[model samples]
Target chain A: MKHTLSVLVENKPGVLTRVASLFARRGFNIDSLAVGTTEDPTISRMTIVVSADETALEQITKQLYKLINVLKVQDLDPEEMIDRELVLYKVSAAPERRHEIIEIANVFRAKIVDVGRASLTIEATGTGDKLAAMEDLLRAYGIKELARTGKIALARGSRDA
Target chain B: MKMTGAQAMVRLLQKEGVEVVFGYPGGVVLPLFDALYEAEGIRVILTRHEQGATHAADAYARVTGKPGVVIVTSGPGAANTVTGIANAYMDSVPIVVITGQVATHVLGTDAFQETDITGITIPITKHNYLVDDPADIPSIMAEAFHIASTGRPGPVLIDLPVDVSRGEIDFTYPERVNLPGYKPTVKGHAKQVHQAAALIAKARKPLLYVGGGVLSSNGAKELKELAELMQLPVVTTLMGKGAFPEDHHLFVGMPGMHGGKFTNYAITETDLLLGVGVRFDDRVTGKLATFASKAKVVHVDVDPAEIGKNRPVDVPIVGDARAVISAITAELRKMNAEPRTDAWMHVIDDWRARYPFHYHTSETAIMPQYVVERVRELTKGRPTVFTTEVGQNQMWACQYLRITEPRTWVSSGGLGTMGFGLPAAIGAQLGRPDHLVIDIAGDGSIQMNSQELATAAINKLPVKVVILNNGYLGMVRQWQELFYEHRYSSSTLPQDCPDFVKLAEAYGCFGIRATTPAELDDALVAAFAYDGPAIVDVRVEREENVFPMVAPGGSIDEMLGGIPGGPVSEMLDEELFEEVWE
Candidate 1:
């Protein structure tokens, strides 16, 4: 099963490598991961999506705590969390179908982040599903390039405590 | 108040009550070694190899219950400690390894003898530090020892750059260690302890499975108290060999692959298995899905990660084994727990009577088991510690040695590193000079760090090195004979193997070789009587195999050799049990 884990760790050098090496060593594939400074400058929060079972995830969580830098670990409920991924897709836009591509992007609340002579780079930011939907709809126009900032997440206000 | 980082390090060790340290020196570590020279309290032994130094320190920690200390130079010296670190990590031995790194300015530049020692050891060590400032030395040293000796203790590393060591600081050993994130649960949860006690009280066939954690936590007293009070039969893992008194009536035997026939059977037959500090490793629980299938397990350990890593448990208590056991003992007393019905003991006794661990002997050939048994006999009623190299020699030693006390039998259990025994003996002997320390090694493995005979002789620590001299790497040879088509290949030792006796003599230690059973006891006696280190090389049968062995994928019930029905599956059929007992 795929689970999203929010890990808070010290912002010391090599902390990221330590965290990443752990996931790799345990055979847990990180489908998506984003690390950034938390409200406290000394601590960094990592948003990671790992594909593992409940038991393996438990083991991984315990192993993470063993790291001197790691402070806390939490498994976020997909339904009770607000998550987003930012993606930029360069779709080949024919002069005739350019309006159609823009219309689909508009429906998805995406914007044209970049424009080339023959392509429009659509920047989409929302939940994983929303970005995937936009990318699927733009595929008809032929995507020339694509890049994504893997998903980042936080629990909803009910869990703000 | 100003002192160099290296000076502060020596001071901190002195404060920690470190009597001796084992290590090898190189360019980057010259400052630390220089500091040692000026220091008064600590003693240092220079090992021939960095790996040997680390292993020696590791053994020192295992036998003494004090965190072992190692100091070595950077690059090769630092990298060489990796194996020892991992070995200590896997076995949960408390060790603090301080490695000299290239100066901080040249760290990332890959200057001469620069290696990412901390990065390399990150996974293997419980925790590690790369010292950038001399002032942090006291805190880092304090934290390093604290982490290494705390809950689920393991090796911790401190990478001290030469520049940092050269820097001066106002050295003050921290009065208190404050790490918000590093709290170990020393006390058990009352409710869980109650639950475990209830489970045991109701169990008709409760078996206490103990592991290395019991010894590390000093839980052996608590474990024995509970076992005796409840009349719970105990089976130890290889790492748990000395945790429970071998002579105690409640003690059954060590279990798992290469375990005794009755021990494996008893484990298979138990209904309730209270695993204390045991991970139920694959070697201990062969064919996991089938292992203890009917048993409801209650696992108590200090490391929560190890609780369900291999096998699931019904009741999981995450705390120090000693504390948890004490809690359970208290709870059991309140509930008035009773011993299980005597029927189970009858079965265990029958199995013991039918298939005891025994070795055949001859007038001409020295049997390895006989040698171990004799060592146990000679070392009886003495403060003796035994360690062994990996493979057949290790198994035989584990099988035959009588460990009456905790911290008496130390081996490379988890990692099973081959060259561990000899250097480990040096460490063990140094730690307990009044006690007898012996390394029962195989001909193949003793050669790995036999140069450590140099370390032992130079120090004049009277450790005994007993070599079970079979002409082959006996364990692998046994495997090839059983599994493969008997192509021994590289399993065979060279025909012209080094004369261990001559080698020992050259190293300025007592040396003797025994080829017959009559000579085995005399060689051991002479070796033990020697005032200095000695090596007793006993030439055992070339084809002799240590067994009660489970084939790689086979269940514990499916033993391959050593016992009567071993290797012949049909013999283990109901007919054989009935016939053998009759």
Candidate 2:
């Protein structure tokens, strides 16, 4: 099972290395990680996605807490959290199929961020499943290049993570 | 007052109440050494190698219940301390290591004697720092010591760049550290303690599975009180050897691999296992699924991460060992809990009597177990600290040496580092000058750090080193004999291994060799009376294996090679016993 963990840590040099090294040492592979400063400039929030069972997840959470720079850890529930990932797709488009790709992009509320003579770059931000679905539809147009921002998450409503 | 970072570090050490430091000086650390020279109230013992210094510092911490301090130069000096730092990390010994580094400008350029020590020690340290500014020295030093000595108590390192150490700053040591993420839980949750107490009161066969945390937290008194109040049988891990009185009636011997058959059986059959300050390590819980399967576990540890880590728990309390045990005792008393393990004790006593730790006594050859037994007999009722190098010598010491008090049994329990004993003995002796300190070492292990004899001899530490010379890495050889068709391979040492007696004499230390059982007693007595560092090389049976063995990954109940003519012999399949015996 994949768990999206929201970890708050001190904004100090080598803090990211410490957190990453811990996950590596414990043999837990991070599926995706996005780090940025929080509202408090002195602290940073890291959204980490990892696949682990209940026992292993508990162990990972507890071990993360042991790091001296880590302040908080929360396993954000999929049902109670909002998750988003931004993806860009550079699709091969012929003169006849360029309109088809644009129409498909419009249906998913994606934007044609860049257009070259032979390709159309579509930018889309949504839940992982939604983005995957949109990418499947765009595959027929021939995806020349694709890049994903990975998943970043926040708890729903007024709750803090 | 404004001072150089090197001087500020010495001031911080004084503020931390540190009196002694073990270190090896080099070019990068010359500035720090100069500051140490002028520093009052702190004495620095220059060790031969950085590794030995780290080990000595580790042992000093274990003996004195204070965080040991170490300072050394960069690069090779810093790299040399990795093994000792890792050993301390595994065993949770508190120590602060300071390494001199190249100037900040040349840190990543691979300047002479430059190394990223802070980067190297990340996983092995509880916390570490690379000081880029001298102004951060006071807070970083305070945090380093605080983190190293509190909670689980592990090693911490601080890499000081040459320029940073030379930089001037006004040094005012912080009175208290303000680490938001490092607040260790010291008191157990009331409800969890109540739940644990309820389970304890209801348990018919409760067992106290103690570990090193008991000693680290100074909870031996509370542990004793809890056991006596509930009449619980206490079985300690190897690291927990001295945490409970070995002579106490309720004290079962060390459990798990090489533990007494009765003790393992008690662990196997117990209804409730109150794991106090113990992480259910793999060595202790052979085949985790079958380990204490019948028991409801109530694990109390200072580190919350340890609870339900290797084993599921019915109740988990996160708190300091001493505080939690005391709380549990008080809660049990309030509930009027009484002794209910009479039948369990009867069964345990029967097994203990039937399957006592045994080895064949010989007339000509000196049995290694016999040597350890004699050491125990001679040191009985005396304040003695016993340290052991890894391999068979360590297991023998664990089996035979009876430690009646905390801080007396110092060995590398977690890491099982080979060359820990001799240096550790030096530190132990230095920490507790009134006690008789001895290192029970193996021929192979002693040779790894034999150079430490120079440090011991020069310091006149009077640490006795007893080499159980079997001409092989005995533990690995035992595995080969049991499971690897006796191929022996590279395990055996050459017939002409360095003469340990002569080696000791070369270091200006007293040396004695006891070849037979008759000469063992005199050799030990003479070595103990030598007044300075001494080494006794005792040649023992080459093939003797530490028995009552649970084959790796096998359930602890399925033991092999217990006492001859004992119940285990009959309990085990005839063919398997014959195979082991043969």
Restricted to chain B, the TM-score per model reads 0.96, 0.97
lDDT tens digits, residue span B171-284, model 1 = 886988867678888888888898999998988678999999999998888899999888888999889988889998777898888898888887877789999989988898
DockQ of 1: 0.73
lDDT of candidate 1 over A101-130, digit per residue (tens): 989989999898877789998888999888
Ten contiguous residues minimizing lDDT sum, candidate 2 chain B: B565-574
Once fitted onto the true fold, the runs of candidate 2 whose alpha carbons sit more than 4 angstroms away are: A158-161, B564-582
TM per model? 0.96, 0.97
Which lDDT value does model 2 have at B402?
88
After TM-score superposition, the amount by which residue B37's alpha carbon in candidate 1 deviates from its true location, in angstroms, is: 0.9
Clashing pairs in 2: none
Residue B496, candidate 2: Cα error in Å is: 4.6
